[model samples]
Target: MSNGKPVYKLIDGKGRVLIPKELRSAAGMDYGDIVRLGVTNGRVSIRKIDIIEVGDQSPDAVKAYVRAAFKTMPDDTRLSLIAELTELLKQKKEV
Candidate 1:
């Protein structure tokens, strides 16, 4: 199965909300990365770290990442993956 989603537990006496190790690795978080807390639709969401959008990344890096992301898809998903990546690339370029 894919890595389970992050779940926050109560803060400890030291005022730290312990995050599960699996979640941490899945999100690629290292110590000292700033995390964001938010509430939407009455559900609390915690981002392990602030993500830099495509504008903050190199064009070649973005293309490579996109290629890698869609490389493993089964044949049935290749067309859909291409379409989605095209739209995503368009949106990122606009940002």
Candidate 2:
């Protein structure tokens, strides 16, 4: 898949397409990896999602990472996330 050649694939009845092993390797995708799918200009794109373990990070570092991530998120998603976090904090205080 890394040879700059296009590989043809057929979508199954359930609309699932099998990605070849070479293509997956080229994209650095492995089993159990999270992926984000999006459509742009009538073409579908797949992106590997990166997850950071905050348990091992310092509070300041985590905050900085979160701020940077929030900057990349859509305004609606950021607002929704803020609302969800506020609700969680309210519940925690009640507990």
Candidate 3:
């Protein structure tokens, strides 16, 4: 819905709904990934619990990757991951 596209999914009798791979992968989610759900205006929103890179081989790759990856991570995890990645990237550059 963020891109003005609508996604249709099926909710089963047991109150479970499966999110397709494309959408999940876009949000950096895979099997057993933790997600948080919230309701607003009678609509439910699901957010990924962590960041996962899905970028390609290109220039400014780390910058691009981190920005996109940060969008999906939970607030609590974002800063720590950024700090870790910053240190890692610095180390990579030093090598």
Candidate 4:
């Protein structure tokens, strides 16, 4: 009865509806990747989680990536990994 997105019907004795293969391909989701779902102010958005490779798990590489992320973050958001690290270092020095 809804004219929005196409709805799949539950079939057989069990209630199960499959995700359309076309939609899955469009979303870039695969068998093993994780997905995060959230709704804010009544708007919903889905984003695929980033998969970190083995080579990128090193401390130096991770720190570099985090620093790069901070550089591109918007000025309005004061929350930053760099600021948190700085505060942690200052606290360590005081101890």
For each candidate in the order shown, give its overall lDDT on alpha carbons.
Answer: 0.65, 0.79, 0.72, 0.60
lDDT of 4 at 51: 41
* Candidate 3 residue spans exceeding 4 A from truth: 1-4, 51-95
Best TM-score goes to which candidate?
A: 2
lDDT of 2 by residue, 1-95 (tens): 67799999999999999989998898888765656577999999988766545474867546645765776799999999999999999999999
User: Tens digits of per-residue lDDT for model 3 on 1-95?
Assistant: 45759888788999899887778878888665546577999999988754433544555445545566666689889989879989999999999
Error in Å for residue 58 of model 2: 28
Task: State the local distance difference test value for candidate 1.
Answer: 0.65
After superposition, candidate 4 runs with Cα above 4 Å error: 1-18, 51-95
- Residue-level lDDT of model 4, residues 1-95, one tens digit each, is 13347655565667444556666677786654444456999965556655434575777557645655555578755466558879999999999
Q: How does candidate 2 fare on TM-score?
A: 0.52
TM-score of each: 0.38, 0.52, 0.45, 0.34
Candidate 3 TM-score, true structure as reference: 0.45
TM-score-wise, the better of 3 and 4 is: 3
Q: What's the distance in Å from true for residue 61, model 4?
A: 22
Least well predicted 10-residue stretch by lDDT in candidate 2: 52-61
Which candidate would rank higher by TM-score, 2 or 3? 2
Candidate 3 local distance difference test against the native: 0.72
lDDT of 2: 0.79
Candidate that beats the other on lDDT, 2 or 3, i.e. the better one: 2
